[model samples]
Target: MKYQEFFSITIEHSYFSGGPADLIVYPEEKTRKLLEKQGFLLKRTGTGIKVLLPMRDNNRVFPVLTADDLFAFHVLPTSGTVREFTDISEIEEDNMILFTNEGLDIGTIELIKSETVKEEVFQNFPALAKIEIKGNQITTDVIGTPPVYKAIFDSKSIKWKYYLLSKSGATDIAVETRGDQLQFNELEIGNNSLDPIITSLRLNFPDTKIAVFESSVAIPLSSKSIKDIKLIQRDSVTQTDSILMKHLPNPSIYDQGIQIIKIK
Candidate 1:
């Protein structure tokens, strides 16, 4: 069986400073089909929900940042006077907004509202022959500028397991057993001593051949059944209080009790 990835999104749409629509609008049929093609399946009746399934083990996913490019239907009626410019020079002479459908400014709506040219505005523009604009004339030779496209991947979510153990009472330790090894992933001691916890764990799991303790505790157990005690400590030397757990197949032999070797 595979686990489901659950997520939710809330969208507030506005255009031209109009108040947002009162009702929550569902995605159009075409948009839903596009998302389905990209492995995002939406609910049959719900809004702003996607049901993700684990199709592969290492599959990664991210969240969409902006929906500014998504299409929406709009209705407006207007009439404008038509004028023609004979050449690029004529258009530049007017000092009007230089608009383009193909080169450099594709997919963006830029309004050249002022003569005060901003350097960053043209940072990605086709290189200019000259930087200075003389008397409403762009004194730059035109080059074959390519269209600009940008994609950003900024957010991702991972599945994790967390346990919040209270420190005021018994230390909470979580472990997994495979074969003869008892592997602990996390151990939190609030106010209790490590000795009682290890003693209880040994009694509870008497058949465990090897005790793998992943935490700050280096306290050796009294039970001889635990022949090999592997302590996961951050440094080679044990701290006054702390535990770490890294795995190893063959444990070292030490007559003094618990053996700790820092991972190289």
Candidate 2:
């Protein structure tokens, strides 16, 4: 029933490559008791110990102990002989160290970065979020009944809007649609200028029908071909009244943006 039992950790010999770990060990009852006494709740899941430590600003979560931390403990056998240990306490301030049950230093856990968390969120919940990168702007949409969109357009400009699309950039050709309104800036284009953009949109949404409208001009598209085009307008609405609704689709568009959107 402990948190560690709910989760598991595996140490690999190589990261980003396929290699088995030299040693793989799990927390014993004694180790769990020690961590529990220190206010760490352990949950046992199929993956490994889900160790929930008290939230501290500097604390981080790592799935495995690192080689550097292992060096300090000096791997010793179950026998009486002791192994030579390295003095890593001097660099301890720069690293986070974790110990193994056998009294050996396993490794230092690396700090979890924001990018890593974003990737994890996308990978694990691919249907619930949308990740988009255009030029220097990074936009994410966590769409549902009450959709939430987070955008990091620039390091200095970070904003979140609820049910509204905001515009930026010169000429404001970059259009974002939210709620019941579509907004754009400096909209001046002819057939040639809109063709590539419409083609890109068709390429992005191959499964859905695309209709581009500019004033009284409406172009219904069924194929992926770009010819003469000017201004382009793109919008998506989920069809809720289709006879094939069950087989219609899942939220897969966000995967193109490296995000996942989960709707409850």
Cα error, candidate 1, residue 72 (Å): 6.6
lDDT tens string, model 1, 1-264?
243443322221221123222222244444456455545554422222233433346643333323322311111111110011011122243232222112223233221222222222122332111111111211112442211211101111111122222223223223333353544455333434365545554466444322234523332222123333333223335334233333332221222223322221
lDDT of 2 by residue, 53-98 (tens): 4534553332333332211111111221110111222222323223
After superposition on all C-alphas, the RMSD of every candidate to the true structure, in Å, is 24.9, 20.7
Candidate 2: misplaced stretches above 4 Å? Answer: 1-42, 45-48, 52-111, 114-189, 197-251, 254-264
Which residue pairs come into collision in candidate 1? Answer: 167-190, 214-245, 215-243, 215-244, 216-242, 216-243, 217-242, 232-244
Per-model lDDT: 0.28, 0.25
Number of clashes in model 1? Answer: 8
After superposing all C-alphas onto the true structure, candidate 2 shows an RMSD in angstroms of 20.7
